[model samples]
Target: MSLPLPLIFDYEEIAGKFYPVIPIELKVNEKRFLTRAYVDSGATFSIFNAEIADYLGLDYRKGDKIYPAGIGGHICAYIKDIFISIHNIEICCEVLFSDEFTVKFNLLGRAGIFDRFRVCFDDSEKKLYLYEKAYSDFR
Candidate 1:
């Protein structure tokens, strides 16, 4: 089933812009949060705040530590496995938990869940379309 991506407005700009944001449920062990996440195609991996790890009983300092770069710069983080649910579809994937508070919200990225679906963004209407893809179709 195809789903719509709810958009959030960024009032920081002159007129501000809307970003495609969707409701997602993140699960780790017994901890879970139903939060909003931005869909970012440029990002290589899903990124979340370290607070989530801490809330989920993870050290947030362990795991495979590495540096990931963004438009602002690079930051150090640890990779961990997490389960995310969107549009009633759930999947387990690798996610980066950054200790720095620079990341204000969770980002849904290509490597994690974005690659699993066909996505389309329509700025005129501020709408996003997502469709789960068949493995054979990608092959």
Candidate 2:
């Protein structure tokens, strides 16, 4: 099935440019938080601010630890399974929570999402096409 997601136009003062952001709901058991996240194909794993995990009352540090590096430097993060709702489609996946990731937006990356859907970014239309793959499609 093909699901087209409408992106929210977010303007960044530093870049003076607008980018497409996706609205997602993060949930841990009974707790749920709605927020916008950058759909980044370059990122290996979905990463969220530690504050979000705290908001969900998660003991984030108990998860596996890893140091993910970027242009700025490496930062500590913990991997944990959480449910993400995109367009009301809920999926449980592993994500990283970090205190040092101070970016303005959370990231929906390759690990969990890309593995399940074929993502097409239509920059001109400012939208994302998420095509859900059947089990046979996985090689």
| Leading candidate by TM-score | 2
lDDT of 2 by residue, 1-139 (tens): 5444432343322375555477889999999999988889999999999999999999999999999998899999999999998877677889999999999789988887887777777666655677765666743
Backbone clash pairs in model 1 (N, Cα, C under 3 Å; residues 3+ apart or in different chains), count: 0
lDDT score, candidate 2, position 72: 91
Off by over 4 Å in 2: 1-16, 135-139
Model 1 lDDT tens row, 38-91: 888888888988877888887767789989987788989888888898866777
- Summing lDDT over every window of 10 consecutive residues in candidate 1, give the lowest-scoring window: 6-15
Candidate 2 lowest-lDDT run of ten: 5-14
Against the correct fold, how does model 1 do in TM-score? Answer: 0.82
TM-scores of the models, in the order given: 0.82, 0.84
